[model samples]
Target: MSNEVVLRGRIVTGSMDIADGVIAADAGRVTYSGPASEYRGKAGPATDNILLPGLVDLHCHGANGSDFSDGSADGARSAARYLHSRGTTTLLASLVTGSPANLVRNLSVLRTLTAEGLIAGSHLEGPFLAAGQCGAHDPSLLLEPDPALVTELLEAAGPSLASMTLAAELPGASGLVELLAPRGIIPSLGHTAAHTAAAAGFLEHAAAALSAPSNPTGRFRPTVTHLFNAMPALHHRSPGPVSASLSAARAGNAVVELIADGVHLAPETVKLVFDLVGAENIALVTDSMAATGLQDGAYQLGSLAVTVDHGVARVDSTGAIAGGTATLLDVVRTTVAAGVPLQDAVLSATAVPAAVLGLSSQAGDLRAGLPADVVVVGPGLTLAGVLRRGEWVAALAPTA
Candidate 1:
C-alpha cells in the first residue's frame, strides 16, 4: 500500500478555491487535489475546515523572543519553530542593520540553520540603507552600497542569502541592483526617501540588470520592502516610492510586500493596495521581530532597544515603528477581515512571496507534484493544524 494522507475541506490554493474538496499527499508531494466527490482512491482522513497552502514569508525578522540577528543558532531555531507552528512553512530569516562584522557573524549562524531546514534562507534588511529612513535599524550603522561589502556578506551567507533590502536612491544603488540581479538574489528597495522619478528609474535599471546574458533563468525581479513603512508617504505633488512601486507592480515589473498587520498600515490602505495592484503583485509579509508572539514589553531588535505595547513594537530611542507583532497567518486574517477577499489575501501570503523568492515551483501552491505544505484553519480563520512536507507539525495540533 502507498503511504498517503487525505485532507478534506474548503480547499484553497494560491489561485483558486474549491468547496468540499479533497487533497491527497503521498511520498511528500501532493498527488491529488480536487473535489472530494471526484477522488476515486481510498480516502485517508477528513476534516471540515479551511485548507490552504502553507504560507511563505519573504521578510521576517524574528519571533518567540528570538531575533535572527541575535547571533545564536538556538535563537534562530526558536524563531523558526514559532513561525512553523503558525503555518509559515517557508520563511526567510531577516537580519537588521549592524556593523559589517556583526552582519557576517549573524548570517553565518543563520546559514547553518538554513542548511538544517530551520529556515528557507536569509534576508539582509540592511547596512545598505538610507539613513534618513532607517526606521527600526540603527542609523549609525547604515552605510552606502559598497560592492566589496556586499560581496563579503553574500559570500559569508553562501547560497542562504536570498534577499537584501536597500535604498534605491543612494549613490551606487543601481550598481548593487546589477550585482544582485543575475545571482537570483532578490533586490528589494526600501528604507528610502526616493521620489517617484528616482524610484521608477531604479526599477527600470533593476529590470535591465536582470536582462543581462549571464542570467539564464531570468528569475531576477525587484521588490518593494514593506511598502509604505520606512519610505516617504505618497503625496499628490511629491509622490514617493509608494506610487512608483504600485505602478511597477501593476505593470508586472515588480512585487511589493505589505506588512498589513494593522500596525504597519491602516486597514483601508491595505484594502486599497489590494484593489489597485491585485493579489498577484502583492505579497503579505509579517516583518515580525522578537516581540512577536509575546506579551507587550521591552524587546530588542538588532542593536536597538524596542518596546512593545498594545501589540505594537517600536524603537525606543526614536519611537519609530520597529516591526510587527503578528505572524504571517495573523496578517492574512487581518487582511481578510479588512474586506479583501480571502483567496486574494491568501495568495499574497503564499504564492506572491514564493514568486518573489523564485521558489514558486517548489512552494506557494497546493497543486499536484508540489511539496505537501498545508495549513488547516477553523471557520473563523484560526489556525488549527499545520503540515510541512506531508508530515503533521505537532505544534499546531488541532484543538477541539
Candidate 2:
C-alpha cells in the first residue's frame, strides 16, 4: 500500500498558474506538479479549488493569544502551531524591543523552538530602533547599536538568529550591519527617522557587506521591515526611508515587507507597492501579536500593553499601531481584494519570503522534490484545507 496524496485544481506554482493542474506527493515530498494531462500518476478528481504552496512569514510576532516575546516555551509552541494550521508552514518567530536580559531570555526560548523545527528561525524587531519613530515599542527600552550588546544577543541566539531590524541613521548602524551580514543573519532596516540620503547610503553599505565573499548567508539583499510603517512618511522633498526602500526594491537590491492586513495600510497602498516594486521584491508579512485569532481585548506585546478593537491593534496609551491581528492567509485575501493579481499576491506571501530565509528549495513553490506543504482554497479564495509535509493539517468543506 502506497501512502500518496494527490490534488487537482488550478495550481499557483509561484512562477505561473496552470488552469488544470495536478500535484502528487508521497512520503512528504512532491513527486509531480504541473498540468494534469502531463502527470503520469493517477491524479485526484478535478475540482474548482486553487492550490498554492504554504506561506512563509518573515515577521510574525505571535498568534492564538500566545506571545513569543513572553519568554515561555509553551507560548511559543502554541503560537507556532496555530500559525502552521493557518497555512503559514514556515515563519520566523519575531520579538519586540525589550530589556537586554529579557531579549536574551526570549531568544534562548525561541532557539529551542527553532531547533525543533516549529519555526524557521527568529527575527529581532528591535532594541535598536530609532526612538523618535519607535511606534508601539517602548522608547525607554530602545538602544543605540552597541557592539557588546549585539555580540551578547548573537551569542544567545546562536545559529537560529535569522534577522534583526535596526534604524540606519543611528550611529554605528553600519557596523551592526557588518557584524550581522557576515554571520548569515540578515540586517533589516526599519523604525527610523532617517531622510533619503542616510537611508540610501545605509542600504548601499548593507548590500555591499552582504555581497562580500566572506558572508555565509544566502540572503544577499537586505530587507525593509514592514515598509512605510514605524518610519517617516514619504514626501516630495523629505523622501525618508520609505522612498529609499522603494528605490532599492525597484533596483532589485532589497526586499520590502508589507503588512497588507487592511489595518496597517490602505488598500490603495498595497496596490501601489505591487505596481512599484512587483511581487518578486515584496515579502508579505503578518506582524501579528498575541491578539491574533482571538477576540478584541487587552494583550501584551513585549513589555507594552496593547488593545485590539475591531480587528485593529494599538498601544493603549500612545494609540500607535501595536502590530497585526491577522494571519498570513488573511493578508493574502486582503491583498487580493486590493486589486493585486491573485498570482502576484500569492507569490509575495510564499516564494519571496521563503527566498529571504534561504528556504527556497525547501519550501516556497509547488516543485518536485520539495516538501508537500500546500494550501487548497475554494471560490473567492477562501481556504478549504492545508497539507504540511504531506499530512492533512486543516481540512474544511469547500464553499460554493
Candidate 3:
C-alpha cells in the first residue's frame, strides 16, 4: 500500500504560520501542503479541526497510571498509548534517580521499547542532580555524576540513549557536560541549587560550542527543565539559576519546560515565563503520572506511593506534589485558557521541545519533508483530531 495519506482541515503550524488547508503525506512524511482547494486527490473529510504538527514532550515523568521511574515495560507501553490520545508523537521516558542497578534495569527495558518504536529513548533525570534541591525525586538516590556510571548507562541503553539531566550546582558538572557533549547525549540543567555564577558557567560550555565570534551558542545553552517547577522559584532580586536560564533562552540556545496545568505554575507565572523566554524557547510538558487520563485516585510513583485528589498528585507519605495528572493536550489548552497566544502555545508543545533535543530540523515541523505526525485542534482550541505517520489516529469528524 502507498504510504501517502491526505488530511484536510485548518492547518496551524510553526510559531507564526497558520493556513486554512489540506496537507499530504507519503512514506510517513509530509509531501505537499496548501489551501484545501489545492488538494485534488482523495482527502479526509474536513471538520472544524485545525491541523497541527504532532507534539513532542521532552520532560514528562510518567502518565496514564504509569511512572517511567519504575522503567516497567508494561508501564511505558501504557503511558505511550495514553500520550497518543493527547497528540504526542514522540516522547522520552524520563527516569528519576535510583540505585545504579535499578537504573540499568530501566535502561534495558527502554532499549527494547525503542527497538519496537514505542519510545524515542531514555532521559535520565537524576543521580547527577543536587540533593538539596531535589523536587519529587528521591533524595537518597541523587548523586554527583560519575563518568564511569554515565558510560555504564550509555551501554545499557545502547542506541536509545538520547539525553540526561544534570544540575550545575554539583562540582565537576561542567566536566560531565563536556563528557556528554560529544556523544549526542544532551545535558540539561535541572534540580540545581546553583547560583547565578554557577549557571552561567554551564552556559559558557554550550555557548562555546555554538560560536562564530559574531554569533554565539548563547541561544543553544543546554536546556533548563521544568523552569519554575523544580530547583528554585524565580526571585526578582536573586534571579538565581532559573533567572540565568531565562536569560540564556533570550539568546536562543536553550528551551525551558513548564508544567502548564495551572497547579505546578500559576496562570500568571505561566504568562510571566512566556514573557521572559518567548514561545520558541518554551516546551509545554504535562509532567504527568499514571493518574493522568484516568480518574483522580491512588497510584505509584516508583517505590513511592502517591495519591491524586482533585487531579493533583502528591506523594502519600511526604505530602509532596509527586507529579501531574494532566496530559500534554490539557497543558496546551491550559496555556491558551491562561491567555497565552495560541501560536506560541502550540510551538511550546511541538517545535520548541524538538529543537531543544536537537531534533528540530527533522521531527518538529509540519512543513513538507517533516514526519507525517500531525494533529488537529477544534474551533474551541481543544484536541479535535490526530494524525500519526500519515495515518488518521483520531478525528473530530463524524467518522474517524
Candidate 4:
C-alpha cells in the first residue's frame, strides 16, 4: 500500500513455463516479473493467486448492478472496480440498442471518462443490428447501418471509441467498417442472420473495404463478438457466420469472441473451437451483464428487461440468451475443466484478447513498458489473487 511495491507469487505468463517468483512495479506499469532474487526493490507478497496479466474483456456489457449505458460516472466506475476485482482491468464499455440521441449521450459520457482514464471507451452494440437476432437489445432501435449515422457516432464517440458491433451482412455496414476502421475504432460483427453466403460476402467486403489502399490507415480487422450466442448455431449442412468466423481466423484475418460461460456454448464444443481455430485465435470473454459477480435476479441490459436465473442470464420473452454473469477467470476455469491446457486457457483470457484488440505489445505480455495489470490463480485453478498496476486488489490470502 506504500511505494515501489514488489509482489511475490507464482508467475505464469511465460512461454510454456511457470515459476514461483516476485513481480515488481512502480507507479502503474510492471517494473519486473521474475524470480524474487532478481527483483531489486521493496517487496510485498502476492499470495494464493498467481500473478499474470490483467484479464482483457473484449465483450462485456456490465456487472455489479451497474450498466455502462446507465449514464453515471459513479456507476461506470463501480462496474470497472467490480471487473477489476474479478481479474479484468481493462474493458470497452458495451452499450445496447437505444435512440440516436441516447446513444450520443452515452458516448459523450464515455468520452469524458476515457479522457480521464476512468474507463476504456465504449462499444456501441446498437442503433444498428438485425432485429431478429437482437437478444436483449431494444427491437425498436434496430436498423440498417448507415455510414453517415456511424460517422456521426464516431464524431460523438471521440477518439477513445474502442469497438462497434454490427452485422457485416448489412448493406452499408461494410462501408461503415471502412470509415470507422481508419479512426482506430474496431468494427465487431454481431446480432446478424448472415449465414454462410452472407458471412463470406460480408468478410470479403469487409476485408476489401477496410483494407483498401484508400483507407491504408484503418488497419482494422473484422470481429465476431459473443460467438454462438447472437449468431446462429454451427451446422454440418449450413455453418453460416459461425463457419465464416472460424475460417477468417484460419485464414489469418479475424478474431472470434467466445463467451466460454458454458451456457452460451457447450463445454465440449469449446474443444472443437480450439481444434478448428486454435486457442490463440479465441479470445475468452465474459459478455457479462450487471448480474455478474452478484446474485442472480431480474436485470436490465440497456432498456430491455432480462432475467438471470441459476447464474444464467437470458431473455425472458423469447428465451434467447441475454448475456453472461461470469468473469474472464470464471470462463477460464470453465474451459480448463473442459480440457484446455491452463496456459492456453489463460492465454485466451489474457494475451489472446489483447492481441485481437491490437494491444498485445502494450498490455498483453509481461514485458518492458506494459502496464502492470496482472492476476494470480492457485495451482488447482482457483483465483488466488489479483493486482492492478502492481497493487494487490483482491485475493484469498493465506490464512496461516
Candidate 5:
C-alpha cells in the first residue's frame, strides 16, 4: 500500500510563500515542500486553496464544553480532539488559579494527556500570580512564589510541564525562575502589578538565568502570558509590565503571547504590538475556555462562574473578561483583520508558539522532514481541511 500523498496549493509558511506549491508526505512525514514544478513525484490535483502549517497554540484552556481545569481526563481529551480538528495540531492545556490540591490534581490528569501525545504539555497560569491583577482568576487563590509548592507542582506535572505564569514582582520570583530554568520549564510573567523597573529586572534576570551556561537544560526563554491582559496598562509616568514585556520582546530576549481574539484587545492594539516588536517575538494564542465552540451560556474556569454573551466570556461575579471563545485559527483571522500581514499572523500562531514549547523541530512549519501537519484554507482564510501527520482530520468543500 502506498502511504504517499501530495497536496498542491498556494503554500504559506513561517519564512516563505509559494504561489503554486506541492507538499509530498509519506510515512507521516513531509518529504518535499516546494514549487509544484520542482516536485518530481506524482502530484495531486491543484487547487486554489491556501496550505499552511498546522497551528501551535501555546495557551489554551478548553473547547467543546470541556475545560482542562476540570481535572477530567475524558473532558480534556475531548477538548484536545476538538481543537485538533479545528486546525490547531498542537496546544498546551492551560489551567487557572486554584487551590494547591486542585492544581496538583489537574496537573496529574493533564500529565497523562501529555504523555499520551494528546497535548503538548501543561501550562500553569495561576497560584503564583499577583492578586491585584488576577483578572478572571480568584484573587483569594493567588499565592506568592513559594519554592516548595513550585517544586511539588513540578513533580506533579513531571517532564510534561512546559510553562508557568507568575507575577515577577513577587519576592521569590527570581528564585522560582532559577528553579524553572534549570529544568526546562518556562517561567512566564503575567497577572502582575509590577512597575517598569521591577518587571524589566525580572525579565532580564530570567533571560540571563535561562541562557546561562550553568543551566543544564537547553537554552530556554521566558514568555509573557497573554501580554497586556491581567496586568497594569502602560502609562507614560508609570509604565508597568506591558512596557517591560514589549521592550524585552522587541530586543528578542522574550516572546509575548497575544490573545488577538478581538475581545481581549482592540484591533489597533494588536497592530501596534506587531509594529513595535515584529511577529518573530509574538505568539498569538487562544486563551479559550469551555464555551469556546459552544453557544453563549454559562461556563466554568476553575472555580469561577463565567457567562458568555455575544461570544465574549466574562466572569459573573467580578465581570472581568474571562478566557476567549476563539480557536487559534480564529485568532489568526482576527489578527490578519487587524492589519497584520497574513504571513506574520500565521507565523505568530504557529512557529512562535512552537518555539515556546520547544517543538520547533517536530512541528510549527511546512518543511521537509517534519510532521505532515497542515491546514488547508480558502482565499478568505476559512479552514477547508486539516491534516495531522498526513492523516485527514477535517475535510470540507473549498470556498469557490
Candidate 6:
C-alpha cells in the first residue's frame, strides 16, 4: 500500500509557478511537486484550483477569540486550530508588553503549545520597548532593555522563545542583542525612536555578533519587527529606524516584517516598500490579535483595551491603532491587490517568513522532502481547503 496523496491545481510555490500541476506526498512529506503531465507517480483527483504553500507568520498574538497572553493551554490551542484552518500552518505566538512575571507565565503556556507542535514558538514583542513608540502596547508595562531580564525570560521560555522585539536605542539594547544572537533567538528591532545613525549602529553590531565564528547559531539575520508601525517613518532628513532597516535589508544582512493589512499601511506605501526592497527581503506578517476572525467589537490586547470597528482594531483608551485584525492570508491578498506581483506577495507571506525563523528547509516552500503543508484557494484567494502533513485539515477534499 502506498501512503501517497496527490493534489492537482494551478500551483504556486514560494519560488516556482506551475499552471497545471500535481503535488504528491508520501508519508506526510512532499515527494514530487511540478507539472502534472510530468508526474511519474500515481495521480489523485485533479481540479482547476489554485494551490499554494501554507503561509508562515512570524508575529501573531491570537485569533478566534483566543489570546496567547491569556496563559491558558485551551486558548492557545484554539488559536492554533483557527490559524491552521486558515492555511497558516507555521506561526509564532506573539506576546505584548506586560509585567515580567505575567510574561513568564504566558511563555510557559506557549512553551507547551510549541512542544506539542501547535505553534512554531513564542515571539516576545515585549516589555523592553520604548514607551514613546509603544503603539498599542501598554505604556505602563514598557521597560528599558536589561540583559538580566532577557536572560530570565529566555530561561523561562526555554527553547520556545523564537524572537523578541526591543528598542535599539535603549541603554542595554546592544547587550541583549549580543547575548541572544548567538543563542539562535531572533532579536528584532521595533518600538523605537532611534535616529538613523543609532539604528544603523545597532544593526552593524548585531550583524557582527551573529556572524562571529564562535557563535553557535550560524549567520543569524535579525529582523525589523513590523517595520514602520511603532517606529518613526523614513523622513528625508531624519531617516530614522525605517531607513536603517531598509539599508540593512538591501545589503542582505536583514529582513523586514510588514503588516500589509490595509489599515496598518497605505496601499501606495506597501507597494513602494515591495518595489524598493524586493519580496525576498520582506515578510508579510499579520501582527493580529484576538479580534482577528471576529466581528467588530471590544477586545483585549495584552492588558490594553482594544476595540475593533469595521475591521480595524484600535486601543480604546488612546484610540491608537492596535494590532491587526487581518490574517496572513488576508495580508497576502491585500498586498497583491496593492500592485505587488502575486508571486512576490505569496513569497513574502510564505518563504520569507519561514526563512526569518530558520524553518525555510522544513515548511516555507513546496519542495520535495518537506512536510506537506499546502493550501487550496479560489480565484480571490479565499481558502477552499487546507492540508497539513498530507492530511486534510478542513472538510473540503480534492474531488475527481
Q: Who wins the lDDT comparison? A: 2
What is the TM-score of each predicted model, taking all chains together?
A: 0.96, 0.97, 0.91, 0.90, 0.97, 0.96
Question: Tens digit of lDDT per residue, candidate 4, span 300-358?
Answer: 88887788889988777777778888888889889988888777887777777676566
Predicted candidate 3 versus true structure: per-residue lDDT over 233-285, tens digit per residue? 66777778887888888777677778999899899888888887788878888
The sequence of per-residue lDDT tens digits that candidate 5 reaches over residues 1-400 is 7688788999998888999999888889999999999999878778898999999998999998989999899999889988998999999999999999999999999999999988989999988888888999998888878999988998899988888898988889999999887777888999999988889888888877787666554437789999999998888899899999999999999999999999899999999999999999999999999988788988899999999999999999999999999989999999999999999998998888887777888889988999999999999999888889889885321111
Error of 2 at 149 (Å): 0.8
Model 5, residue 369: distance off in Å is: 0.2
TM-score of 2: 0.97
Which stretches of model 4 miss by more than 4 angstroms?
Answer: 14-16, 36-49, 208-219, 394-400
The parts of candidate 3 lying over 4 Å away from their true place are 42-46, 207-221, 394-400
- Model 2 global lDDT (CA atoms, 0 to 1): 0.91
lDDT of 1: 0.88
* lDDT to native, each model: 0.88, 0.91, 0.76, 0.75, 0.90, 0.87
Clash statistics: count for each candidate: 0, 0, 7, 9, 0, 0
Q: Could you tell me the C-alpha RMSD of candidate 5 in Å? A: 2.7
| Candidate 2, superposed: residue stretches over 4 Å from native | 394-400
Candidate 6 colliding pairs, count: 0
In candidate 3 the C-alpha lDDT for residue 15 amounts to 46
Error of 2 at 234 (Å): 0.7
Q: After the best TM-score superposition of candidate 2, give how far the Cα of residue 176 lies from its true spot, in angstroms.
A: 0.4
Q: Report the C-alpha lDDT of model 1 over 271-311, residue by residue, as the tens digit.
A: 99999989999989999998788889899999999999999
Residue-level lDDT for 129 in candidate 5: 88
What is the clash count of model 3? 7
In candidate 2, list every pair of residues with a backbone clash: none
